[model samples]
Target: MIQFKNLTLRRGVKELILNATLTLNPGSKAGLTGANGAGKSSLFALLMGQLHADQGEALLPPHWVVAHVAQETPALAVSAIDYVLDGDRELRELEARLAEAERDNDGVAIGHLHAELARIDAWSARSRAARLLSGLGFANDAIEREVASFSGGWRMRLNLAQALMCRSDLLLLDEPTNHLDLETVLWLEDWLKGYPGTLLMISHDRDFLDSVCSHIVELANQTLTLYTGNYSQFETLRAEKLARQQGDFERQQRQIAHLESFITRFKAKATKARQAQSRIKALEKLERIAPAHVHSPFDFHFETPESLPNPLLRLDAISAGYGGKPVLDNLSLSIESGSRIGLLGVNGAGKSTLVKLLAGELAPLRGERIEAQMLKVGYFSQHQLETLREDDTPLGHMQRLAPDAREQVLRTFLGGFNFHGDAALGPVGPMSGGEKARLALALIVWTRPNLLLLDEPTNHLDLEMRHALTLALQDFAGALLVVSHDRSLLEATTDTFWLVGDGAAKPFDGDLEDYRQWRLARQAEALRPSSDDTAAPNRKEQKRQEAELRQRMSQQKKPLLARLAKLEKSIELLTTEKAGLEAFMASEEAYADDNRARLADSAKRQGEASAELERLEEEWLALQEEIEALENGYPQQ
Candidate 1:
């Protein structure tokens, strides 16, 4: 168990946590969340024994082995699997001892060392390391490749794999899903759920937290508060507590009203896909969380597009790749005005390439790309952060973007992204990744793009900024095509899902759940046994197997699809009723001096209808995907 008693943690003269007392019992998985610079990492440091509490103690059992992802991995020529195996300190030490004993011809020492190795199951170390690497999205060949050959993101994953290799009593992970794709994120989430240890994770990814964390510990305002349950549960409980206060009542109501109207809809969306599940849950709880930040530091939204052409862009018979090799062949897709789409595929399946083509950063190797003359793209990707002039202040960057605009106007705009006071005027060289990312987005948004192409836009954003961005995108009156691992954002914003793989880009008929099952089936098939003989099977035997499989699948899908249709129809009817009630409630007539009673009744009915609509929609989407999985299988990427 890890415990902090009267913990007064500080950095320099600035107090972070004051007299905070919290205890995490052994095998209890918890999530630590707070605003950026709110001492989440500092608290982690306290537990790791790297930072001493200013006044009290941060304690762990003396014999407990603690594991955390390394912040940096040195450039090493060793195989990635071997590097991961190095995390097991005891294993490495024992092996070193065994080698020395063998060289010294000490029979007794060698026998004892081998016995210890067997007791610890050291023989399976390589296999365990390999599993971790693969789960983190490293292929078998890549696992055997030199560690230094990989990129920075790959190295970070290697570090994570190494941390997971340790059979520790306590595991600490900070932004563990930072560089992961949706598939890898799901694998990691499932893996963490099954981890038999005390886990404390610091993450801005709400869905990941909900999936793996049993409880949440919130750090804010120099206080540490413990909440039992996942992030959503914590938000609701906290909202209820905050609602009791006079200051938060009105704000809470507004948040609740928004949630009441959309919760059921978002909840339905959550069950539709793996990425959406987290975002949908977060959306449900945002009502409660919104009140906590009534005076939230960030408030921003995209400006309405100048012109929205019917087809914003179009690709015909495209063959796109690099170095004269095509990654996507005969790919054709169209982006229309008011479209909200999320691109989905496995890692290295050319999502980035497709985004690049859409943004006009990469030209198609062979094909025609027809763009609307009025098309104005606001593109954002990780590379944009690198392109920011380090010495320039946020204000300076914006000034250059709009040189003719008034300084006050630019300052006001920057403030919307929370670049206020000295922070806005300070040089960006010292800015953190979150700050840099915000600046990049602020610049892109300032352009008033009619077509937004975002690739992992929330990579370094905290939960608050992400929430703000989600709201902004919701109101964005332009076509949006986003590539992101943040489930909440995708679920809340995207109206459609596009599958980009198999050397083609195509509309995916089903939601995230369907894709997830397809991926799982694909993986299972890949791992399934291969035939020893290449001889063709008898036609009758093959035909019989195929027929039986089809019948079994159809039997399972038929009833589920019927339920799905029933739910969808119920949702549609309720949604239409709710929309009418909501519109009437919002009308000036309802809010007029003489119609207060009517307004109350209308609002109540609208809330009820929305809730029912959400419930049905959620059920429909989940069932629809479940049936789709049986009807449509995923091909290997």
Candidate 2:
């Protein structure tokens, strides 16, 4: 069990949780949610022992084993399964002792270690790791690949897998589904439901929360409120509470106003001075009830497109992919005006490729792509955030897009995206990812395109931003084609779904649940043994083949291992620097009014360092995979 008794947590000058008390019983699965910058991450930090509460007790059982996904994963050359298996610390420690005992020929110690291993079921650990990886969308071959041989997103999945592999009493997952595809999200939901440990996760995916959370813990207004039941239930209960709070607030205001009036008029009279003083004392003692605030800070709507042309874009038997290789082949699809479609696929299944092809960013290798006259396409992707000028402000970006628009007009428009006044004027370099995403969205909405091609548009968005976008999309008159893992957004905004798999894109006949079933069936089919295999390969022959393959792979491993060493050093340095920056930002002096410039500089440097670290890790992965391919006598990609 975990307990926060009158916990007061602060970051710099901002008080996040003030005198908040909550108890999470053992085996409780809760969803922690709040608006962006509402201290959800800070709370996780507190629970993980990375941060101490400013004033009060945050207690967990002394013997409880807590597990959390590491924020950074170095480009390690270890096989993915080994990395995941490392999560079982007890198992690893026991194995180490067993190896030492065997070296020393200590039969007693060896027997004890083997008995302990049996107790923990360590013999099946590898298979367990493989299954965890598979559930997170890793292929069987990928499970044997080096950890360095995966891109950032795949590495995130690996981190998640490692966290899940831990045999612990508590698990803390922050935005666990952010890097996942819809199929993987479904798999994770099912997995979490069966988890026996206490789980606290932070996520903007409402459907994921509703599916897995037994209780909802909301962080708002410097307080922690625990509501029984799922997120939908939390919303209903919160709304009703807010309604009552509003009524109470209004009544309190009237009573206070009357008290003030009585004190003001009668205080000047000599005979009534005693009564006036008594009233003043009463007023001073009155507890103030804060007003109920239900409105989301975000408010915006998509404007009508400049032109509405039927069949805005059409792909005729097109083959789309990178470097002339087709991930989606002979796919004929069309986007008509007012059509709302969601793209569903596993990671690397060409959802983004299809979006790029539709947005005119990719050239079809085999077929014709046709566009209606006066077609205006607005495309939004994670890449759009990178395209933003680091030195330019949000207002500056909008001004360049609409040079004729007035400055005040542009400022007002950006405000709708919550980039108000000084925030809109600040350089984009120091802004958070979610803020950058909002800016990109604002620019897209400003264009009033007849067709929208959004690829994972909700990636860095918070719940409020997601809700706002959902509402805007619902009211959008233009055709929309979206590739997102957010089931709530898909359910609210899209009328149809297209499943992208098996080198083809076709209309999915059912909703998200049906897509989940389709994915499970596909996975089952892939795992099923072939009927053509009449007999198993001879064990000696299989061993000989594996020996030969390993011998060849060992010859090519040296250079990749050297490069990995260098990458590890670079990653460590960058990680340390980033941590120092974070430490400074968390300090009280960093938030001082006079230290604003230094704070901004630290933030910008932190962002640059993180981006560079990601690039280096990605390059490391590519090089490692290339080495693997060469050893196997094949070309990567």
Candidate 3:
């Protein structure tokens, strides 16, 4: 557990956190959410003791261990397992002591060593380490791989796994989900949900927070405010609070205006002079609430040329790979103009390779790849920041991208993406992921290309910026080919889905939810217990025989079907109830009835029904898919 009391952190003249008081309870999962530069990461640093506050103090649990995983991982020349094993310093020391005791052959020392070994063994340290490593997406073989050979993303995962392996009293994670793939992220969500220790994480991942955190803490205006709910609930409550504050400020202004009017009108009157002066004094002494600073909205628009009649890109039986290991084999697909396509697949499923082929960065290993004539492509790769010159300022980068453009024009463009004033002159190398992504986007937009290829464009963007970018892409009249695993982003911005699987590309209608269901069904089929036997069956299975196996399987099918039916019924009932509530809540008369009590009740019921319906639907769909796969044989789509 950790607590902050009147903590004020400053970086030179700029105050980062002001008078912040917060507490992280034991076994509590807390998420810190705020706009960029709002001190979320700074608070994390303060909690980790990496940065000291200029004023006040942080009260921490006595001798409590804390493990921190920073956004950027340090480079190390070591094996991944060795790095993770380092997390258990006590266990390592115990092993060393035990070795010494065995060498000395002292009874007392051996007894102590045996006890220590037993304690370490009781903890199941090896299993815990393996679980943490696998949960963070390190394949069993990759655990022994040298850290230096891995990419930056994999290294970040290694660092995260190491932190998780520590199993400290408190975990401080900053943007922990940034480098994680969908599977690893899901694993982390489950792990954190059941995590017994205190967790204080700064994440822009809305879904992750909603799944794991019990409380949302926001850092804004140099202060921290705790909300007893997830990020979405916090957003709603914060908006309401701001509205109430605005209303109170307005009421005070009205009262002040009345007092000033009375003072101005009665200033020279002999009978009322004292009262007027008293009102003036009171008015002057009143403490005014500063209005909230509003962020300037960036109106982004991507212009696209006329749509091509045929597909802009076509892959004819193409195969791509690295070092002769096939990533894609005999893949064929066509991307049409004005199509908003989302590429969905598991990690290392050739999605990135496909993007490269579309971008013309890689040639097809076997077969033809073609692009339409006059097709101007603008791409934002996952590692697009690498393309930027570290020595150049933002303005300089933009200038290099558009050399013919005026300096004033370049500055204006950079400012639109929140890089203004001195920020535009800052070196690009130190910029955050969000800033770099925005800069890359700004450059892409300046080119005014009709074909856009985006690979995880929402990687580091905050929710607001993600929404803004989604809206911008929605309005753009161009062909979009995006590869991202963010469901919300894909659902909001994509109209078509391209599923890369089994060495081929398949197209699907609808959004990510549909694809998710399809993928889950496929996985269920793949994982379904099979009767294949390379050797003799075990005694337990042989005793059951084929008849008993069929009977058990049949019995299992019945409950699954019944559960599916119940879920369907629940979904239907909730749908009707939600609709009725929405109809009543939308009526103006409902608000006038008994102080809007009926409307309030209807709104609450609607929310509950909607949430329940979503849960039931997800379960129902998963069950139905599983049952269908069990009933029918597995067939490749």
Candidate 4:
């Protein structure tokens, strides 16, 4: 368990947490969330002992091992698997001692170290490291590559894999999904859901938090508030709480009304794909959750395009890639004014290459790209963040775009992205990633382009900023093509999906869920055994063997299936009861003096139920993995 007792944390003159107390029990998965500069990372520092509290104390069990992803990864010559194995300090230490014992010819010491290694299951450490790397999107051969050979993002994935490799009781992750693709993000979710340790992660991805976190701790106004359930539940509860406050009520109502208006209007708009309907539903849900973010600093929308050109951009028989190699070949696609497309693929599968082609940043290796006479493209990518002049500020950048526009107009436009006062005037050199990203977005929106090509735009943005961006994109009457691991953003803004893989880019006739299923099936097929005998097997013998294997597997899974059913039922009952308790707690009546005792009881019961539910969920996940292994013909450990 981790505890903060009357903790007052300060970084220089600024106070982050003021007399905040929080207790996160063992094995509880918590999501740390707040605005960009809201001390979420500072709180993590407090737990990791990297920073001391200004007053009181932050405590963790003395024996518990803590692991966190490194902010920087040096260019190491060691193989990726070795770097990951180094995360297990105990294993590394024992192996060192064993080598020393061997050199000294000490049989007893060598035997003892081997026993300890077995106790820690160190023999399988490499395999475990490989699994982590695989889930993080490393190819099998890449796992054996030298760490120094990988790019920055791939190196970050190595850092993550190393952190996960550590057999720690407490794990702290900050923006774990930053460099991940959607498939990798989904894989990470499953891995985290099954993690047996206490996880405190900071992520802006709402869907990721909902899938992986059992609790959410929000830092706001120098206060820490712990909420039961996931991000969605926290948002709902917070919305209800804010709605009752006189100061916030008016603002909340206005935001809700604005979202409702958008939804009502957009519902009547014809869309080219079923995902458009999904986006509409997502927006409606966003309207319900709007109050939770009423206090967000960001408030901006794309300006209406001067012209709505049909087929804003077109690619014909394109072959796009770097150098002489074609990553995507023979691809033809058209982006119209109403095209709202989400790009889906594994990392390095030509999604970005396609975006580069559409953005006119990369010329097609072989083919033609046609653009409308009125085509105006607003392109954003992580690389663009680097292009910002360090000596210049947001105002200066905007001035470069519209030299004739008045400074006040530029300043006012920048304010919509929450770059105000000194933030707008200061050099971009000292700005945080989120601030720089906001500035980049402000610059793009000022162009009033009819086409937007955003690649992982939400990488450094917080939840509020992400929500604001989603809202703005929803209202933008232009074509949008986005590549992001943030499922919420993809679901809310895109009406179609294009799968970029197999050396080509093409329309994927399905939603994200379907893609997920397709990915799973693909993985299963890859894992299934393949024989190179070339000769066709006898059909009758193959059928008999398959039947026998199925019978055996069915018998083995029967008990596990029964247990899974029972666990599901138990989880359902507990969840319903917990919801009832939370509903009471959210009610104004729960705060009354007369109902204080009842409130306390309900709170206690809710905590217990949450813990129990977490336990059941973990077990259920383990069983699921076991079942999947069986179905895939892999032996469970």
| lDDT of each candidate versus the true structure | 0.81, 0.85, 0.73, 0.82
Model number with the top TM-score: 2
Question: lDDT per residue, candidate 2, 202-238, as tens digits?
Answer: 9989899999999999999999999999999999999
Error of 3 at 394 (Å): 5.1
- Tell me the lDDT of candidate 1: 0.81
Against the true structure, whose lDDT is highest?
2
Please give the TM-score that candidate 3 achieves against the real structure: 0.75
Ranked candidates, highest lDDT first: 2, 4, 1, 3
Going through the candidates in the order shown, the clash numbers are 6, 0, 0, 0
Worst 10 residues of 3 by lDDT: 628-637
Give candidate 4 regions above 4 Å deviation.
245-293, 533-637
Q: Write down the RMSD of all candidates, one decimal each.
A: 22.1, 5.2, 19.2, 20.1
Model 3 misplaced regions, further than 4 Å: 70-79, 112-123, 256-277, 293-296, 323-326, 389-415, 420-430, 508-637
Question: In model 4, what are the clashing residue pairs, if there are any?
Answer: none
Q: Model 2: runs farther than 4 Å from truth?
A: 533-574, 578-637
Quality of model 4 by C-alpha lDDT: 0.82
Two-way lDDT contest, 2 vs 4, winner: 2
Worst 10 residues of 1 by lDDT: 628-637
Show the colliding residue pairs in model 2. none
- The sequence of per-residue lDDT tens digits that candidate 4 reaches over residues 1-637 is 8888998986534688899988999999999988767898878877777566778889988999999998556668999999999999899999999999999999999999999999999989989998888788776656777876554456678888899999999999998998678999999999999999999999999999999888999898788999999999999987877766645656656766765666666666666335546656665676332223457788899989999989898899988764355678888878988899999987777777788889999888899999999999999987677778878988889999999999998888888899888788888765666787888898899999999999989977888899999999999998999999999999999999999888777789989999999999999897787785642466456557656765676677778777866876887888799878766765668768999889888878876786667556545544654454344321111
